[model samples]
Target chain A: MSVEPLDPSTLPEHDNLPGNAHAYCVRLTGPLFVQTGRMIAHYPAGGGTIRFEPLTATSLGTLVAERFSSPLYSRDWVVANGQGHVLLGDRGYDINSYDLDEGNLTVRAANLLAFDAGLELKESIVPGFLTLIGTGRFLASSSGPVIFVEPPVRVDPEALVGWADCPAPALHFDAGWMGHFLGAARGALFGTRSGEERQYDFTGAGTVLLQSSERLREDPHALRRLEGEVRQLGPGALQQLQAVVQQQLAEHQQQQR
Target chain B: MSWRLRTPRVLVVDLDGSRGSAVRARTGSMVACEGEVSFKDAGIGGGGGLRAALKQRVAGESLPLMEVSGRGSVHLAVEAGHVLLLELAGEVLRVESESLLCLSEGLRTDVAFTGLRGASSGQGLFTTSVTGHGRVALLSLGGPPIALRVTPRTPLVVDPDAYVGCLGEVRQSFVTDVSWRAVVGESSGEAFSLRFEGSGTVFVQPEERR
Candidate 1:
């Protein structure tokens, strides 16, 4: 018996193919489905059919890189979908996204860390770090042991607070010199050097999540000044300030809602 | 024949220098005679001459304890089975009582106020005249007796309730208007204050509201 090749335009798209599945496919004009942990898919009108295409090791590596390279984009609010929540600051993320499976989530950006199933990430103005607080599998771009957390764990973002160890450690320079050097190469002599005065870097193992934007460590001096302002307010004033901040947050959340 | 009477606490004087002689009563219960006794004038004095003249009139002997009933009665249980009761028909003046701490020494004493003001203000200006060297004792309710010492240099402020005793020579001025409004409450801006000057001790209680 001879089988005809299906056309890509007529078929549904399956972005991340789970590794556990023996084979998975979506027919043109028909349902795209998976049969590994369970049969999963969405089908069109009646013409579609599926065929088993067993994933090879090379294909799995390609799939991981593709997924990591892109940011998760949803037209509808991600939190509103009941999949997961996002907290931009010191607060914890209240994730309600069930049926959601995490692939090898990579956090490679500067001063970023994640703990607790990648739900809680603390972003500081000073050296940036990510702390995970839930028992789940997570990967990092730096040389850190794979952390398996139990429930109710509090991972300190500062613990993972290190710069990416790279040849261009001078990438983490004070804002004054960095700005001057970037504007023109004339002040490149004053630019930060590698070695004793080099920028701290984290390198070795694990995948990391990096924001497409600049990392906090790019300007350590400015970050320190910002952190100092927050620290000088003291605990009492910090609470009152937090309330005001939370109000602004609520407004932002309402806008998103 | 005539005999002289002598006692450790008082100097009993008789015109005839006779012992146990009945003296003539001139005004009310006061007896007058051509006799001299050793006593000190401790009340507020107008001047040297006036103080001297007032000091010459008082009899220093241990007078009989007069019984008083109605109101504002001052009584002291003295030594030798004698109780001193000062009955005030009008405001008593220029008198000093022995300090309560030194009760054993009956002769050496301090001054006190007996019924300076009557309960009824309707009575038309009643005043008792005293021309002598004497002392009076007063009783204060609540708490132990507080001794406020007043010297020429040291002055004190006291609540009226805590005033137990005062020197006859010390001048007194009343102070009022210390309230929450003048201190802690919202109306603290328009608060009032009291100024006390001169040589006098003022006693104050810890809890004034009660």
Candidate 2:
């Protein structure tokens, strides 16, 4: 087999795509918050026009509503904007491309995948995380390769993938499952066990983004943050949260018989 | 067409069985083979006869090949993705019979209709092409196989979920754009895009097969 055929005049000016680390090739000269369908191929470099928009449209729409302040993930994000070269790709994971310069990272909003509208997207009190504050270039994607630990680490809540400059994770559990959830019949018999006794600990002082595949990647803004916390429950706390979710679906169908 | 890549997603081939060779693959994609191999059923159509088996069941474009040939060395792969290869000589590759996989013995495969965007991506506007010469591999997933060059003033625009497979004579079209169907379903999965211009070469694969 005779390989070698990349063309786009030898791609790779903004990185990855040579022997692919899950593809990425951004050379576009302005605006690029991309995420909308991770664009696979793009080539212009001459007769302008790239466009992707959608951050509530209207072109740069007030600079993407003033730097896309995550409305539970500004409807999947977009704004590839003009010039040429774009090429991004995810779902085959392992993308990389960081360089935040003005710092602040966070990521794991489905492993990011393209940024640089001069960064600034927020919304990340953990839940399906995403921070990105300022200073250019970003492009994450990781199902593997992104292990830059350092910190009192605890990880493994599905291999936690987000933490740069730390301060979020703190729910370690596992003190013998908190003494079996402070005993109440071993908290209903180890509370239907297998939460793997949780983890995520992290402790002060930066960097943590792990990901050698704990296989997550489905967070649709955590169902819009549980429908905005079930629209502020009421009605006797939604019938006591529906009888504790029908006794946790009859103890998960009695532990699947 | 010898075909070697023992790993880049595996694919082997060989075949000499004292001169009586063979190939076909892609129905349960082999995985191993020594000497004197066998395995039948290149059936229903992949053999390309009976009017290319009624145009591969009226172009639902199924493929399902498997005719391995004799005299050792098979081994192919599929679900681990990434395999690429390619070597034709007459032209015409088209692809997407689940991104083909193995095809050496005198090549040919059919089906072509490609109209309303592979039937709105549910994969049925048809497109399997192939043609003479030999060697064709291809299996893409998230890596290996980026090759985009389509000239005539360079027009490419892919992303019909990272559409994989295209060799030459290009010219595809589809685009849509009504603000990409007004940012449909909050983008991240196509509001239509497959543009490609004539001249050839365009095998993408950085994930996105939805």
Candidate 3:
């Protein structure tokens, strides 16, 4: 309950606020890539300014092209430049910073708060996650404290945050559930999912990141990714997808009723 | 009698009827009360009379308050938010109307213009200002409030959604530069941030207002 106000000089570089786990303070010397809207506050250096410019800004075109490689996430990230201490938060999640010295790590896009410009960011082939390569530090948030686990494990899709030095996980379906789905009576194939029947199986040598809670945060980039994938569908496939969406809308309306 | 924090989210006000002790609190914030206590509306103007009422109407910074008095202690809370108690010693405490939970009888609440800075923060154009010597309770959303110290050398910039309030001599203004441009498809969410100069303390919450 004792809150000693912190100034730039006293604030830690890349650490959670004292007595608070939901907010983090980062001392900025050069440029840092930050997720849009995650910045809570910042203290500029004496007579200095910390400018938050979009990745699309012309002044940052060359720098962004060099450090940032994810097109789907360009709109969701900004380049923070100048000298100062910046505080970042994400919906009150637990914030943690990880340093990668000539290593790589992949993390969920929505959970990543910011990363140093020294690291290069690339789009992970596994869809909603982004891969950070080279070296430097990055900040990410989780619904609860992150739990580290070795490979040769299975994790709930909703609880899986990201994995490091591991191959993308393969979708694993419970044997009993698969038997039920493959049975002659396929009527319950889509409607009778208990949600626990599916998990991500990791068999390689690497570490997996998992949140204590199974609650999932709504990802803003998910829709855009789906939109990008839709461009590859044929005309007939597009019509069938529309019909499926209409059916989903009808079912959703019925549930509301 | 004064304010005692029962928990981070709960506040209890000890009142003595014989001493004519009373407090003005946000309407619908009382959770429980012991002994003989009564609640009364703080009138149309929220205690500052006709002029304040007109300003509140125009500024959309309406504060609906209720006066609590009697022989017992009253428990107060709102939206399950964390409570921050402050002892005001005559310095003006400018805060959001919605964040105000309780105020001592001696303090006065009024509306003040905050210019375009408030507009981008989604706090409208006016903010509620409290003055006088008394106890004040503020409600912070998401988590415990963080107090940042500002001086002549270091200026602070804050996202409007995360800003709670400020005390002392601080000047707030909106900065809309090329960096404030909205992305191609997305709204960029943080189009601008409130910049504070001079020497003062600024308070911010851990979570932004959605």
Identify the leading candidate in terms of DockQ.
3
Give the best candidate by lDDT: 3
What C-alpha lDDT, on a 0 to 100 scale, does residue A74 get in candidate 1?
A: 10
Q: How close is every model to the real structure, measured as TM-score?
A: 0.19, 0.37, 0.92
| Chain A TM-scores of all predicted models | 0.24, 0.37, 0.93
DockQ of 3: 0.66
Q: Rank the candidates by DockQ, best first.
A: 3, 2, 1
TM-score preference between candidates 1 and 3, better one:
3
Model 2 over residues A128-182: C-alpha lDDT tens digits?
A: 8778887887888878788888899797777777888878888877787677667
Candidate lDDT values, in order:
0.26, 0.79, 0.85
lDDT of 2 by residue, B85-165 (tens): 888899998888887888888888888876775334555357789988877888888777788888877778887667778
- Clash pairs detected, candidate 3: none
Q: lDDT tens string, model 1, B1-210?
A: 121223221222233233222221111221222434222222232122333334322322111222111112111222221111122222223222211211111122212222222232211111112323222222222211223334444333333222233333455543222321222232111122121234433222111111
Cα lDDT for residue A174, candidate 2: 77
lDDT of 3 by residue, B104-208 (tens): 888998898888643333463688899999888888776788989888788888888888888889888876665575662375467667888888888888888
Model 2 residue B1 CA deviation in Å: 10
Better of 1 and 3 by lDDT: 3
